[model samples]
Target: MDKIKISNLEVFCNHGVFKEENVLGQKFLVSAILYLDTREAGLTDNLEKSIHYGEICKYIENFMKKHTFKLIETAAEKISMNLLLNWDNLEQIDLEIKKPWAPIGIPIENVAVEISRKWHTAYIACGSNIGDKKKHLDDSIYALNQRETCRITKVSDFILTQPYGDVVQDDFLNGCLELKTILNPKELLTCLHEIENAEHRERIVKWGPRTLDLDIIFYDDLILADDDLIIPHIEMHKRDFVLKPLAQIIPYKRNPVNHKMVIEMLYDLQK
Candidate 1:
């Protein structure tokens, strides 16, 4: 990744907790560091292949002026999201908002907030065992694709597999997807849950039957474990249904927790 940085660009915006602060407006210092791959532009000397700082600055000015929010935190968030969404080449952003004029009775020189946001690559496992299983799986993929902030980069063909665990049920149609998302892990989980609910998925038993089941197999090689979610899917390498499709899409994607590639995991599970 390479960087293009901007410093202390001024904007006059009405954003504050005090009434007069909003009415009179105040000066704000906005700065950003855009992270991206500049190799294409560097090789060809093509401006088209690169991000235009002028346009991004103009967008920041216009966005700050057009929106009124009480907290600079909200302002920073919106600005970061807007830039990430509009600029396809921008892989990440580090933004800072500085307010030189403070309404606080104390003599503070400035109030500021800084934030970083980036796109994450995640692999998702999709499975269905109840009613029109294939349709449920396909519908889930369509739902994910519809989100503006999420993009489906690759998909494995749906494969039929026996149900895991002792609970007897119909066979499942399972698949995997390579996804690029601006949504953070928790946000992405929420979105997946919404799609599962739409398919009338039920969670009566652990590893049990369901109309649709969507799990985050991997998220940017992140190893995370909490009450609601687990990365590398908590024994995913032991499950053929998961590894079969995962290897199809990303055979070389490593599991940060186990230090094994999808291909290696697939073969190891088979034996």
Candidate 2:
């Protein structure tokens, strides 16, 4: 909730659409606000507990000088993402990239791009129905933990469950993991897919047999429906395997659409 602000820091970099802009270079001004919890630092009077503004400025300068982009939009996005990845305490960032002396014929003050990015909390249901199920789940957790943008905060005990769909294969070892992530929904989905593929998970049939199954059961309070992904997992409320393990860790987590807690859903499903 607290912020550390850096205002109008100037840098010289090559980032522009025109040919001459890249050849000759130009001046860029950046403004940033990093959101974080500084309470511990304030209470303990420890500099390590807080983000170092000087270090951040140096990082931004280096990043801008090192990379050449055609647009300020790209520069802003890359810088924001880099800052978020480098700083663990940073919860959100408001970044602005200003380009002065534009090639436009008009005498404008400056052209700038401003944007905000933040981390989201998401819950994933993980399962494996074939070939070292426990190993599959453990490896998935280890993979998530290794990511800089994501942290595995908690995991539920695995439960043995019958196959939910018509596929007659093996019972699944299902569980859930709660993650704190800086990755966007789509990025997180991509990471999950990559992890699955690394485990050699074969999707021969829907809900058939898998080496690892990672589903985004909840993403903040978001309600999303897309061709490749669905948020709050469409059938999570009805599946005891999901609700049971979810209840073990996040009993109070609510279904975005139903507005019912996981504990309530699990209880109701029993009858």
List TM-score per model, in order.
0.98, 0.93
Q: Model 1, which residues run further than 4 Å from truth?
A: none
| Residue range with the least summed lDDT across 10 consecutive positions in model 1 | 229-238
Q: For model 2, what is the C-alpha lDDT against the true structure?
A: 0.93
Steric clash pairs (candidate 2): none
Model 2, residue 62: C-alpha shift (Å): 2.2
| Candidate 2 structure quality by residue, lDDT tens digits, 1-271 | 9999999999998999998988899999999999999999999999899999999999999999999999999999998988888788998999999988888999999999999988889999999988999999999999989998898889999999999988789999999989999788999999999999999988889878999999999999999999988998999988999999999999998888999999999999999
Highest TM-score: give the candidate number: 1
User: Candidate 1: how many backbone clashes?
Assistant: 0
Tell me how far the alpha carbon of residue 170 in candidate 2 is from the true structure, in angstroms, after superposition.
1.2
Once fitted onto the true fold, the runs of candidate 2 whose alpha carbons sit more than 4 angstroms away are: none
Cα lDDT computed for each candidate against the true fold: 0.93, 0.93
Scored by Cα lDDT, where does model 1 land?
A: 0.93
